[model samples]
Target chain A: MPFTSIRELLPKKDLVGFAILALIIIVLMPLFLDIFRLNLIGKYLTYAFVAVGLVLCWGYGGILSLGQGVFFGLGGYCMAMFLKLEASSPEATAIQSTPGIPDFMDWNQLTELPWFWEPFHSFTFTLFATIAVPVLFAFIIAYAMFKRRVGGVYFAIITQAIAAILTILIIGQQGYTGGVNGITDLRTLHGWDIRTDSAKYILYFISAFLLFACLFAAQYIRKSKLGRILVAMREREDRVRFSGYDVANFKIFIFCAAAAISAIGGAMFTLQVGFMSPSFVGIVPSIEMVIFAAVGGRLSILGAVYGTFVVNWAKTSFSESFPELWLFAMGALFIGVVMAFPNGLAGLYQSYIQPWLKTFINSMLSKYQQYIPAKFGLGKPAQEAAK
Target chain B: MTTTHNHKHKEMALYIEGLTVSFDGFKAVNDLSLYVEEQEIRVIIGPNGAGKTTVLDLICGRTKATSGSIKFKGKELTRLKEHEIVHAGVGRKFQNPSIYEDLTVFENLEISYPRGRNVWGALIFRRDDEVRKKVHEIAEMIFLGDKLDSPADLLSHGQKQWLEIGMLLIQDPELLMLDEPVAGMSVSERKQTAALLQRITKDRSVLVIEHDMQFVEDIADRVTVLHQGKVLSEGSMERVKSDPKVVEVYLGH
Candidate 1:
């Protein structure tokens, strides 16, 4: 629940010490690498942030929602729209405002700003739009499906359908959304020095901080009653339902959480990349997010981060080098890991690292059972578990 | 003249009336009517495919009843979902030791407390001291106190059953419906399990569906024999053993 081992390693009392450790490490990032490399690393963090929700939804919930990219796209579009509007001077606010057309569209023959795109021009409104839209969509869909008790393969099909529809809508809305090309080009975060090296580093820090926060939040929930119910739904849904909990509410809540997080991650990605395209938020990307978690460790929060980094690193390093079969290589990795270690890399850690750690702790406890008296506290958990 | 329904006169923990479960037209549990009393260790003993589990499935909300009513603790259980039934104080233990085998025996129980069973509650780590103490007490009672730190899969078969029973115990349900709790247990383990069940039955209602008649005889307060998806006879084993119809059904001659 608490990332038990990490929490144990860094107890609440010693948190300050770890914070200082993190600060020192972060400060050293610029010292070891050039500004260009720092930006690259920062870009990676944005991708990791975007993948966080997918990890929770697919890895823990087993929903296999193939439409998470919809949220990502929404968030990205929201951020891009706000940045684009902010770029235009106040003097340019109402100048005939090209009708039924984006600026790029105006370059063709379109004349007026689509009414739906009007609200997004405001920074604050766009911010809410990004998060609220995705969460709202996810909530409605999850509620309808879960309330009716549709899950497993059927749930998967419905979500994939949603993604397909979203992809088509975004591509076809030539007068509303950016169409196939998607909103892009201009960028700046509230007119801050977006091109500055410090800004890039700042974004990277925020991404890392957000990742840690989400992990912490997920871990807490996993330890809490709500997580147990979800697990119960996964294992014995009927039991949880008879217990008086509305299983639909539980499913919907997690579904919304996943979508909202995915949206925020998408916003971060858009901010970092200075662009948005329909390709970025399609079924392919949605499936890829799930694949990352599956190969890392479905249920482990830390494993999700591990997975996002691993798969992305592979793609970045080798996709272009052997473009003819990069997907083949990626597919091979997925099959290989799933076949050999269903737990993913985290599973690898659990199966291998955990045993070693347990033995070490137990041995330490035995030696210090008296005198130092290791706080192994084994019996307490057992007695409690039996209840 | 006013008359109360004679059937509802008997207060029951579980009231099953004409519970028919049809699979594509064939009756899995046909015209099955049975009542389990509060705290009664009612054993449903029937041969394989006699719909012994179908009854539990219907009761626990695993399988839908085509036409019947199941009222547990005066609440209609037929309409409730599985997890809701669990919260309504009915706990189900599967034939397969259904636990995260990779998790430590204690961790499994840690993740099973009946509190905060919502998505928001799960995201917030709120551990009540009382639940923790109860878990400890259950683990000790189930004789798994020694192996608390060990992963569940590594535990012996008997211990795993004890652990699962412990999980059900933590919920502190009004009724614990266990299926084959001691199916493959060793003689010593069976004896230990029988002792555990006896201790548990003191407080909660237990309905065990077991194939081992000796195990059933060791634990059952009353036995109900089911045949052709119907309640063939209900009485003490000694009395049911003497019933001609029950004998014919069991012998199948």
Candidate 2:
């Protein structure tokens, strides 16, 4: 009787319905947005990818890996490198209305592309590089840290340092790496006309689908025993180990997956936005990733995507709409959500909609039963008996 | 193999031959050899520096043996990782309360619920009616059938300990190792825990490290006194209690 009743309170089936609803909303977004609006939404969805990765590593795994932006930048730079290379051939360069190097890189006196920049001229290689680069970086770092048993604030410090160092290194290498300006002047991907409305719409839809994929995969993992193990590792690594699980392997797995997700987001982002900069890999963006996951609700995957969308929407709408007062609005929003809705939008849904719908449905069912008796002329007899 | 284990019992469930565990340069557990038999509740009593916890560490694979072999059920346990040791039927509970506090009592059990000990199978584990029935059956055995709906943190110290033991039991390890199981408990609670341990050892071996002599005397099938990283004396509770060395070491007589 204990679990029999307790099990009924669980939301497993209702959660599926919500996921289906989310998918429908995502699939139909392009129907409403124009090319320009779709491009903007695609950019937002790309950032949602970074948020999804953050939720996996920092939220679920208890690894505050601030260097996700380093992987993000790595992936973005790899894609930007390809786009820039494709833009820079003498025949290709002559066809561009503006110089491929831009006026600034040309002023830096760079005539040819760097050696590492050569192979990325092909789209296939850049796409491969995007996922591979982050996975490789995550593998090395997680192997060293988790194996050595370095945890707590030490993990945070080390990952943050990686991002800080990457940003500085990129900035210091001005010409080949583009320094602070960061290898811009990207015009197209795979020689396609990026300015075309249909092409841009297709990109937005691709981003939406990919976001759904990442979100679904993340939710599946969380619902699975792996998520529980990762949470167990976060709370007590020694206990999970004592329970007969390799805690480090779980950490490395989630960390690498997160890095790969961030990398994909970065690649998608640079392609859609036409720029990559050292600022993208800096400490601020790294902090923003954690804040989004925390403020959104780290436990839920939808919370991660939703958090990213809300934070970014605030940044886009309020910041752009208000300009100078954007930072204050964002701060207020963070404080408000953390104080009022500690579990993020997911908490809001649980508190407001879940019980209400249940009760409403129960009422409707009873009314239907009452109406059926009347339809058969049984209601009058029943009412008279009750009186 | 220059090392020779000098213990009399050859049929020991746990046999440590020349086991040495050191952190940095200091040896926490010296080249110490010990043996534990099946279904015996062996209480390891020791002073602050006696390395009682460290011995548990070396046995459970939390701390590596510098140059030694740890054998469990006649299998060399030195190369096995922590999870592998547990899979090999060695369960360890830490000195601290390590139960998942945020999750419900049932959820804590569900998280620790056994399903063939493979990641793939565990990942795909859904609500199998049989597994649920078995879990509830185990819950009833530990007297936690009524408390399953409560969050883990809401349980009393004794209940939490029982819940942790229950979590280990569903996996059904052959050897259950606990560090300070009754470190904090009332008289009735300690008695209840003692009864639970007695019930458990019917099918599994228990190694408990406790500072409370009364709690140890109530449950320990045998007592092994550790002094400065070595076994000072080990025998039946009455035998160890009356030994001159134990009196001298513990009571300063």
Candidate 3:
């Protein structure tokens, strides 16, 4: 029933868009690229999760959160903790001062695991915590800022500050958190070696599957009445409030949902990249995630996914050749997108490419219409097609 | 004072007393007391800066009252949030049209249909037959039935005003407060709006703030003249227009 409802909610054009994106990511990319490049693409797709969330939260809901990395980091760290625990089996860490505890803790002279780390020993708990912890943290931040009506730039700055703070805290608490190096040397998930090439391939599919799930969830929210309300609130908040909606609650929900989605991406990142670091949890990465959404067309969910690919692909290629100039290039790209094409790649496609493509297809179909039998009715006549 | 005694026998839809709102030591609405009876269309007329719009703002919870109580359907409203006030059966239309410009006229009215207002509810809310019917009904009422699918930004100035009113009407609030409903409307639009107001006010009380005396005379059941956030005069249009103090303070200009 929900699937049917979602089908009804998504228009035909959007379904086509989704299908094309799925084909490219799931089939073409894996088949064409080697395992190394496929792994890289998988890592990039993880960022698409954050971009998709931004499409709903910022584009639809008019919230500009600049600290999505914090949620992503939290999720990654949660999964990393579990993986670290699995790897730190008494036999594996027998040489360490404490055989059962993580190496970072032993290195810091800790005799036992922290209370928080103890639960990570259970895969089920760790799996739940990856999404739940980020959502809980997001809820708290959203409730505090939204309830006080602290929004727009202030909200963005506050979120950025939180990203900075979380990075510092993790770096400072080296003993418990793996510190600036982040939780590294994760080898297995429940006795299965995750470092193998086949493991990377499997993880890539899993990440792609999860990204689709999040995308569908976002699409559902975007088509629901809640989605319209978010747009309404963005245009005129007082009008929406006067219509009897508790505006703050909706904002909080979207923000928390965005956090959960970003966290999932973070978990995938940890799985695919084999490490969760402070570098990914800081303001820089959070802003970079926003750039992914912006360049894709902040308003287009599919655009965000493509945007993530384009920017990250550019980053990898550009930095490999001119590592020193990559930052300047990224800055130029953002400014160019904002100034020339505020709607990003999606808008450009919609305004220019889509219409022309439709016309070209229609003309081609009509040109061949006479060749086909009228009984078969393969294509409509030109006049009807125009209508 | 005499008008208060006269309306005291009737059921009160909205009773606001001692409503005061000060911003940085300037009282926008000062110690204002007003009563609106059931099914009454009360028009508030005053010069610019006479606190007419401020009165609507105070009752609708947009501006919190420093010292006062607003009773709507015998329920205290001063402590309620803006949306809570709306849910409590009090609707307010801004001085300028406040419809969502990006949405269609149908969407604007559908959003104000008074169901699935919470986050989870809105997520699961289906645009069922009843919602569609109500939306169409309200759109027709505001004379935007044909333009239901058109984006609100495409509407003319007068149509936008009507769209905002249609948004408020769908909520079916018992006390509908409109600020300058006819402001920027054409002569024909004003007449249509007056007639529209007369039709919708059949089951609910209306509180309107307007400057056009002609529009006021067409719809006002009782006129309240405000000056410096205080009631300068209160009576029928004829009596208030003739009042010496009202003439000296407001109409004389």
Candidate 4:
């Protein structure tokens, strides 16, 4: 029954878009790219998760959270802590001052591991903590701000402040969080060797699949009545309120949901990339995530994945050759995106490419109308009308 | 489901007593007391800054009252939030048309259907037969039947006003508050709106803040004349127009 109504859930345009994105991610990318490049794409796909979340929370909900990297970092740090603990087991770190403690703790002359790190020793606890920590943090922030009706630029500024504070706290407290270098030397996840190229390939597929799942969830949200209400609230909040909708609760829900989705990506980043760092937890990366959403057309869910890929790919290639010019080029890309195509690549495609594709397909169908008979189950009913 | 709004034996659908809202030093609505009986079309007319719209704002929870008791069907509305007030069967339309411009006329009406208002409820809500029937029913009521699929931004000023009214009608509120429902309307549109208001107010009480005297005379079952944030006269339109204080404050030089 549910599958029968699934067609009504998404429009034909969105269904086509989802199918195309699925093909590229699940089939074409893995087949075409080598292991090394596939790993790089895996890393980029992690950011795509954040971008998809931003599309729901920011684009549709009119919430500009410039600190999504905070949730991402929290999730990553949770997973990284567990992996680091596994790597620095008593048998593994026997030469260290504290055999069972993490190397960073031992290096900083710590005699014992912290109490909070105790639960992280359990993989199950760490797995749940990865999503739970970020979700709880996001819930607290969203509830307080939205309940008080502090929104728009104020919300963005507060979120950015949180990102900055988390980064500073992480870097300043070296022993607990691996300080500036972050939790490195991550070797295994429950005795499975993750540093191998085969593991990287497997992890890439996992990451891509998870990213696509998040995209589907976001697409569902975008096509739902909740999505329309979000757009209505974004445009005229007072009107929505008078329409008997609890506007703040909706805002809080979307914000928290976005946080959870982004957290999953963060966990995947740690698993695939083998480390978590404060470098990805600060203002710069947080703003860059928003750019990924914006460059894809903030309203387009699948466009976010493509946007992240395009931007990150350009960043990687350009930085390798002209490292100094990469920042300038990135700045130009943002400016060009805003000034030229305010709706991003998706908007450009919708305006120019989609109509042409429709016309081209229609023309071809009509041109072949004479060749295919009505009995062949093709062509417009005009051919049948003639018969 | 509606809020626990009990009509009881109370004659008034809406009852406001000693309602006062002071912004800084000046009181926008000063000790204003008004009542609209069930199914009554109560029109409020006043000079500029007479707290006409402020009364609606307070009753609808848009503006907090400095001191007052606003009761709707015997339920206290002072502490309720805007949406809570709406669920209690009070719907408000602003002086400016407030329909979602990006949405179609049908979409606008469907949103105000008083169901699936929660975050999760809206996500799973289908445009089923019931919702479609209600949306079309409202579209026809507002004379927007032919333009149900057209985006609301394409509507004229009068049509937008009707669209907003239609949006409220979809909610099926027991107490409908319309602020300047005919302000930007043409003569024919104003007449149409008057007829529309009369038709809609058959079962529900309507509180209209109208400026046009002719429009007021056409639709008002009773009139409350306000001056300097206080009621100057209260009677039928003919009686209020005849009141010397009302004429001095509202119509005289």
Candidate 5:
């Protein structure tokens, strides 16, 4: 009868945090940045989607998947395949020996399209495959590992190995995939030129909206009893199992969900950046994505978004000026974060900032309450406490 | 090789037969059989490696038995999974007070409320009056009424033990299996726990594995002494104390 479900989904503190983040992305960035800068921010935001999922999968569920880049790459590749097929029209490739196949296929001396690329010709199938493929991969890994009770560091190593394997497979298969360079030169989606400035601006908003939608969903999960059980399982899995919950199923569910979310981000990355590459589907980027979640406050969805943006911004600036110091700086950031703030920025905010802000707000409210009683012509015998 | 079956067709809470388990080549529990009647408190006493804990493990589906049949209320349980075993009205508590330490005492109990066991059920579960009332009742019973908001890890070792019992109680399981519930508890805490167990066993059965002799005498309706993975003696507390075999294997050891 308490309507706790509604309150849990949109708690006051989280509502404020959500509002501030939404305002920064939707209202401030568009007004301030040019099309080029905004599009870059949009690309960074796509990674935020993966970080958000990591917060759920790694932070809450205690599943450290080091192959998230695999899912992201899978999504990006799915979209890239569709876009590449569209870009490789018979009229566009009339000069090539084979007019219909992708240019990379021409370079690799293949006259026919690969079997896998045939499905992406339909936008509908490509759309579904973008999410489904990554989730299916995640399900296989989760089901096998969780069912056998293989977790902790072993799970991390296996996933990282999978990331390494995927990168090699993508790079080695030069004919079907674009090899080291990856699938690039994507031009349009349903005949709309994605490279145009207007389209870039529109895509940035769409990406921001999708990120917030993911944030809302992640928040809902964290507030529910399922989230608490995940936390419990992370701490003591056997206890949860004896409490009448299938621990493996929960693990599989969260892992697949994380994969699906990361895949969505990957697809959006292709739409904005106009390419899908093996560069994004390797161990390095996958671990980097985890750090984005870690630095943001792995437990906080909104924090992961900010974490991704700030880290990427720093990476861009550092690499631009002092490329040599960038790796060292990144390494130190990770070490410093782990040593000083295990919970990251959100933990710091909760511990040091939130309490002070709460008292400040309470004092302001108490003063306002005195004025309210006076305005109503009621005697202020006892001052009401600001909760 | 005999099951030592007691009340074969009665409304027994648990019945295990020929439950053998081996770790590599060494037998942890060999050809073990156990029974608990409805609304009874059965305590298992044993030396260090007498398979007291292993029997509980087999019943709760933690450790798979080599060849056995476990039945609770005439339903086969050995084939069921751990969660399924719990859903079939059996709850287990580990030796080292395995409550969720990061969560508050209320949340620790709330998770075991038995209604929302599945993923979807948990997502839609609301803390309505019924849930709140039940949690409060269990908290009071466990003497944790004043510490509902306190984190479970912050409580003393004895309090954590009680909280674990309260968690099991929230599920309203027909059979409760506890391993060393008073292993690290204070003498006073042990007495309080003994009283708490007495009150809760009015309508349910409890299978306890304990080492404290005085504590055992206070709560156990029947005592089973185990040694070398087999039952050496079993009867009333006084009857088992007088048995030379039980004294040699358990009391002397």
Candidate 6:
């Protein structure tokens, strides 16, 4: 039964998509690109985590959360706190009055380690907190809103407000949170120096590995009965409710799951980029993350990764030359994508490329039929020729 | 008015008293009391805005009653959530066909199968033989057995209506409420649906709100007619149809 379900989850087409993505991320990208470029791609891949979550929450579940950056920021901060503490060992901070505490806290004035920062000293706790903190926060927000039946545009606006408020709060509490600059200069992970090129390569691989793990998990969920329920709830909330499923509970669960995934991405971002900041947790970045999912084909999980890559690649190249026009270009791109191809790149592929590819492959196989052995399942042509 | 006794309460599948729901001071369902017997098929018929649908909404927990108690199989449903009401063995079909158009016909039924309703349960819910068999059974009953893989959006309006009925059937609720099950159906489709309802409602209590008097008379064991959010007449179909007040407000138009 499990084997059948596994097969069902990864059918031929989806398996091919997964394989192609794997080839690009694990084998091709690392082989071709220099470490610097690879590291940049790795950073973009972190955002793909959030996009993947959005695929489930927004694309399939019909939830459009504009506050994902808050979860990402929380996850990043959790990891950063641990890294920041390791970097701020008493011996390293002997120059400051508060030798054991973080530099920002020391700079703020005389102080011991705050209550929240103390647990982060344990790497195990930090790892758990990275996913848990964001999920818990998401649960609170989802519970409050969904219970009251707040959704659609109102939900989106509320999530955007949360992103804004969280950013402001982080920025306002500069002393404890590292303020507008965010927790910075993260030097090591568990006594190993992270600044070396080798570390960057290793971190990139780790991020890729985690991304695939997330992809598989998302794929599994997408195939599950719950996935259909999400779709059902999306189309008709009342119908699902009358079907004896708590619609709000499903919404809350998916929202929290999305948050946990985004938080994972945020933690990876901090590790790869060596900083955690309010800049990534604000409304703009949150909306940008949504664009990543949208352009990828909100309906497609694999599309989310490709979407993140394409959009980020464009942003990098375009912003380098015309930094002022990048935002306008992004706005235009979003509008054009929505107006022309509402499903994004994935939808375009499904509608046009996939069929073309199928026919092309069939024709090529037929052309090469004589050369192939009968044993290779191209036997149909060989048998026809024999007849 | 029937006096409430313990033995009588035990036989009742649904019992509503003083049910009133007001939207901005305009009472949609005003001080209405209704009782549905176990295995009885009760139909509510009225003109537009007579609040036939509102009664179903209140019982199904879609609309909060301004003042009332709805007891489903001895459980109070007015204070319950929609899903909670469903869990207590009440299923509701909306005015329009509300099946998930994005999914397959098989998927629509599978979702309505009574199992793994919670978050973790749904995540780990497997499409084992039991689910598959039940879905196939319901599909066959709905006459979509051959079209199980077909997307629901492609189903005709009548088929969509049956698919929604099939969805509710899979739940096997003790009390099923359908609003205008054959509103847009063709005459033959309406007859087929009436037959479908008769077969499916053997053991369960059905409270249906329908406009077509023929369909209602074909299936309804008893009919309740409403006027201005109040019950105008209640009895067998012939008795309710012959009532002067019921004819004056409803059939006379």
Chain B TM-scores, listed for every candidate in order, come to 0.92, 0.91, 0.96, 0.95, 0.94, 0.95
Q: Classify candidate 2 by CAPRI docking class.
A: acceptable
Better of 2 and 3 by DockQ: 3
Q: Please, what are the lDDT tens digits per residue for candidate 5 over residues A1-387?
A: 213466657976788898889899999999999998999999999999999999999999999999899999999999999999999999999989989999999999999998999999999999999999999999999999999999999999999999999999999999999999999999999999999999999899889988888887888788878889999999999999999999999999899989999999999999999999999999989989998998998888888998999899999998999999987888899888978999999999899998888677667666576566566633332243322
What is the Cα-based lDDT of residue A303 in candidate 1?
A: 68
- TM-scores for every predicted model: 0.84, 0.83, 0.97, 0.95, 0.95, 0.95
Candidates' interface RMSDs, in order? 4.3, 4.8, 1.9, 2.2, 1.9, 1.7
Chain A TM-score for each of the predictions: 0.83, 0.83, 0.96, 0.94, 0.95, 0.96
For this target, which candidate reaches the highest TM-score against the unseen true structure?
3
Candidate 3 residue lDDT tens string, A1-387: 222465687776798799999999999999999999999999999999999999999999999999999999999999999999998889989999889888999999999999988888898999899999999999999999999899999999999999999999999999999898999999999889899999999999999999999998998998888999999999999899999999999999999999999999999999999989999999999999999999999999999999999999999999999999988998899999989999999999999998787788779878888787788755754556678
**Local distance difference test scores for all models:** 0.73, 0.77, 0.91, 0.89, 0.90, 0.91
Summarize candidate 1's per-residue lDDT along A250-324 as a digit string, tens digits: 788888888887777788777767778888678778777777777777776666666877788788889768877
What lDDT does candidate 4 reach at residue A140? 95
lDDT of 4 by residue, B4-70 (tens): 1343443778888999999997998899898888877788998998989989999889899999899
Compute the lDDT of residue B212 as modeled in candidate 3: 92
Q: In model 4, state the lDDT of residue A247.
A: 97
Q: In candidate 6 chain B, where is summed lDDT lowest over 10 consecutive residues?
A: B1-10
Check candidate 6 and list the clashing pairs.
Answer: A174-A179
**Of the candidates numbered 5 and 6, which has the greater TM-score value?**
6
**Model 4 CA RMSD to the hidden true structure, in angstroms:** 3.7
Name the better of 1 and 3 by DockQ: 3
lDDT of 6 by residue, A259-332 (tens): 99999999999999999999999998998999999899999999999999999999999999999999898888
User: Best candidate, lDDT-wise?
Assistant: 3
TM-score of 6: 0.95
Clashing pairs in 3: none
DockQ of each: 0.32, 0.40, 0.68, 0.59, 0.64, 0.68
**Model 2: per-residue lDDT, tens digit, A1-387?**
112332232355436544664664465556676677668878877877888888888778888877778888898999888877766766655643445543335556766555777778677888999999889998999999998888779998999999999999998878778889997877777678555777777666677777777766676677666777777778877888777777787788889888888888888888788889988898878877766776677666667777777787778877766898876776676677768777777677667876676566555655565557455653443344346
